[model samples]
Target: MNLMTLYDDVINEDCSMIVPETLNTPHLVLRYFRPEDAERVAELAGDIHIASGVLNIPHPYTIDDARDWIGQHRFLRDHGEEIIYAITVRESAILAGAISLRVNTEHAHAEMGYWIGRPYQGYGYATEAAGSMLELGFRGLSLHRIYARHLSWNTTSSGVLTRIGMVHEGVMRGHASKWGVFHDVHWYSIMDDEYYSSSVHADHPGRDPSGV
Candidate 1:
């Protein structure tokens, strides 16, 4: 059976528990963050290069900031507002980055966001983790669409999205402000049908609870 048929078969079933606490891929383990991870999160995210590319991360990210952010994951996930995962190396369990889907359950859609630590940038961790999230969003959460946006100048991020089969929606001129400067942003999305039909979706690493 194809993914769309599988999606239809399981659409009305209770999928709240479908997503595992940890999603495993070839080289990474996407899991929930713990309090002890705060220091490492601060260390990695504090880099000026990491902060400048994203809108929300502050340049001098602190342990307290990381704690505050990690502390909210449970409440947000339990309430169906967001699902965030700490991207870790499979063998070492070293935290490499973070990824999330800010879900709008009422609309059956979500926005994807992520960042990899400076040390992990070139290894395709972002793409692997993102592909898992797409599976979680579309297959597990039953979302109609999943979209992501990045600063227009961040071509690397755009490449990741494209590599995962997200179509370029368009650019929003001066759509976001970071560090007091306005910047354009590029938007990309994949609908459920598009996701199920794509070859990339077939190869993405994740356990399909629905047996698609």
Candidate 2:
């Protein structure tokens, strides 16, 4: 598990705006979405398995759906309410998946979530992207806490959360209704102090300077 920390210099004043045009990881690039990505986004996110694992994405994801979804990103970021990124492999620039952070202005915290395309599973891309998001939450955004919840059956999602140094808080029994039935959700979180004290965050070698 190679956990890369967000460089302190990347964050702008007060983190009212955390994302720049793009973020670089050792093997990935997290960047703002473009209209041209609609086709690939639709192809990757259209998997029934992928849609079933997340709360929001609908199955049979269409090109129009992808376009509409990417269209909302700019407005969300401009309002300081959310930060979403398109994940791509650094080597090939393949659209691997998507990740996001939903900010709670009143509480100074955010909910982080991500999904790796079916073809990209088992490559650690989701974990890598999520680690960057966590850095944005704790360091860039000056958030007190960052949390995420996954349906109980989604162990891969749980593993990604664990790999990022988030602690399992507990399970909310049947806390969410999805696909017309209730499901248990596992909650995990990391606080600012915990993020600073963690060896994972401390040993980060800083951002990649090669530029994405």
Candidate 3:
């Protein structure tokens, strides 16, 4: 069993917005994972394309595995160690993916990670959920930095990180091993200042990025 801690409330300017809720997008919604979601999560996470791209997702995903994963997440978030959300669709209610922020309360930073199912590849759901998490990290958690990393060979992951405004911070050569081989990793991040300034500018009626 993966043991986890419960919440220790962190102060944020928009503390009220820190509550758990679903975030909607054109084709999907980011929400909490339920026990019933284990089977579907296993299905989506079982594929080599999805599992191999990630650090810990096993290729032959099982119901027990999924259950344990979600259980660990619930425990961790409840203890305030991290926050995670399931990426699902409103119409189908299928588990399409996941997004999470592993917090470093002392450093006021969190690392973001995600993976989309093989069938949903090429769509923009990854970036969409990523944007939502970034919003939560900066606006709700009041975090100072959010960083992400990917295997150097994974162009798709690199694209998602770059598209979200994180710069290539460099590589960690042979720093990690997966699938019987060592791999290099690319790091990227966004600072709190950038998020805050962008938010203020977007809220100004005349200068709104959405241009309502």
Residue-level lDDT of model 1, residues 46-119, one tens digit each, is: 99988988788997999999999999987777666788899998867789899999887668889999999987
The backbone clash count of each candidate, in order, is 0, 0, 5
Question: Model 2, stretches more than 4 Å misplaced?
Answer: 1-18, 202-212
Pull out the clashing pairs in model 2: none
lDDT of each: 0.83, 0.82, 0.74
Order the candidate numbers by lDDT, best to worst: 1, 2, 3
Model 1 TM-score relative to the real fold: 0.87
TM-score, cand. 3: 0.83
Full ranking by TM-score: 1, 2, 3
User: Would you estimate the TM-scores of all the predictions?
Assistant: 0.87, 0.87, 0.83
lDDT of model 1 at position 139: 76
Query: For candidate 2, which ten residues in a row score worst on lDDT?
Result: 203-212
| Cα shift from native, residue 211, model 3 (Å) | 32
The best candidate by lDDT is: 1
Tens digit per residue, CA lDDT, model 3, 110-206: 8999998876666677877787778777766767899999987899998887777777889999988997899998899989787656532121111
Cα deviation at 11, candidate 3, in Å, is: 5.5
